[model samples]
Target: MSVDDFKHRGRRKMLVDLLRTKGIEDEKVLEAINLVPRHLFLDSAFIEYAYKDEAFPIAAGQTISHPFTVAFQTQLLDIHPNEKVLEIGTGSGYQTAVLVGLGAEVFTIERQKDLFDFSKIMLKKINFEPRYQTYGDGYKGLPSFAPFDKIIVTAGAPEIPNELLNQLKVGGIMVIPVGEESQQMLVIIKLSENQYEHYEFGNFKFVPMLERRDK
Candidate 1:
């Protein structure tokens, strides 16, 4: 954990202003972004650049999504308080904290062991304890915790995982990025048991979502 003093808070306010200009209109989403201490989510050397609306390198060869991207996806989720939100990649727990701050009951998964471990401790240190944090395959989703109210995948996938789609409750929404390289942000609204509505929100890049290869 790192100190979040006036310096970091001022930077975050500026970042929120930048995000506003970038079209992040959800006040709750913007407030969450402003509240979470992104500087603490990065390595010390890059702390100065933490609130610059840019992605920074983190453990497990992953990059935290830029603040704009995070806010965009979050705004698309249309999260409501107490919603059961499943986060597919807990890189640095930054987004998870944002969700928690938005009053969602978050269940986050991290397939990379290093990140899974680091984030578990980091989140605890800051007291942003999500409802559940698991080290497992994102493609598999969380069966026992099925029927999430909203789901956010933090990585780029070659295609949307049907397994995850199965875990969503009817009338829920899922915001994911799908592509081989740069991904188009997709919003999947579960209409019924077998019905869904899909929409795209332009292209963005993210760390590729990884799966566990069975032997």
Candidate 2:
């Protein structure tokens, strides 16, 4: 069979397996996973593995997040239909596209120019373009698009970014991975005007969150 055909079949089956076993309970998120063409976001060589619940290398030393991770994080956000979202590290635009499919007005940032450009093209190709902008420094988040209703960081940071926390609107949620070495924790931070509530779900590992590589 053709590579494209294989990818389509393989990814569909993988999505089914993920929902069946990964404890991913949200129907809307599952449908988005089923509907989004994950293979298109990956390089042709790795397209066959697109649907498996695993991260794959993308350009600029970044990796596309696993499908379960994407679904789990999206579920944590509890995003409303009209909510605005800020995504840090738009590696392959896969995660961004998922959020868009969930009806979010997304704003994303990537520090790697190559990945940023590639994701921009892919976003346009998939019609997943965010509302306000995409940037090269994810650490800074999007101050211009401040007060986002939800924020999801796809990479691992040593600690949660204070700037990103500040940008979330009251009652907004930010899902991120925090760690230093091998293991990272998926943390959900719910913002309030005066206080924040945090919940750490489980362990994970991701590409390190970067500042400006140029600098």
Candidate 3:
């Protein structure tokens, strides 16, 4: 490995250590985070700060989520290998890549065309292939690929969309951040055919989930 590659490996290890300190206990989640190079998902100028436990600005005015947030949401999903997972916001595709690394069959949607296109190429270049990457409204989810075993929404929504809940399979789980301005509640919903259970995991801030595509 080159000097840079060695440095990044050390950075990733430190990041994993930080996450563990922050109460992220899932071994698989930590392994996936360690394997994927977060710096590669960042702009060259911000690459140096990629492993920090903080969000960073990406294209389309979206922020790649802080590492802890990503781990928190992914842990809530409790993903199993080969399970179909729908991600509501692709963002910088960093979270998507982490999902792919964990062996989930990922379907991610992005409202910003620039981010959608950019993330598509970035993920491909990194060899992390999401099953479907769509540029459309996240509130609509992806009905065509309904009944996903797991769903994760990276953006904060004012209200949880019924459409997304409908797409989740009975016995599946959906983790989302819901609120308007200020802090948002990180909610986990477990669905059954006729009933569902809700769990709140405190507050987190995220970019708003917009209704329309970026023009």
> How many residue pairs clash (N, CA or C atoms closer than 3 angstroms) in each of the candidate models, in the order given?
0, 0, 0
What's model 2's lDDT at 215?
30
lDDT of each: 0.92, 0.79, 0.88
TM-score for model 3? Answer: 0.94
In the range 69-131, model 1's lDDT, one tens digit per residue, is: 999999999999999999999998999999999999999998888888888998999888899
Instruction: List RMSD in Å for every model shown.
Output: 1.2, 2.4, 2.1
Candidate 3 wrong stretches, greater than 4 Å: 1-4, 212-215
Worst 10 residues of 1 by lDDT: 206-215
What TM-score number comes out for model 1? Answer: 0.97
Worst 10 residues of 3 by lDDT: 182-191
Best by lDDT: 1
For residues 1-215, write the lDDT of model 3, one tens digit per residue. 12249889999999999999999999999999998988888888888888999999999888999999999899988999999999998987999999999999999998988899888998998799899898888988899999899999999888888888899888889888888884455554555676788888888989888865443
1 or 2: which has the higher TM-score? 1
TM-score of each: 0.97, 0.90, 0.94
User: Which one wins on TM-score?
Assistant: 1
Residue 159, candidate 3: C-alpha displacement in angstroms: 0.1
Task: Mark the regions of model 2 whose C-alpha exceeds 4 Å error after superposition.
Answer: 1-10, 212-215
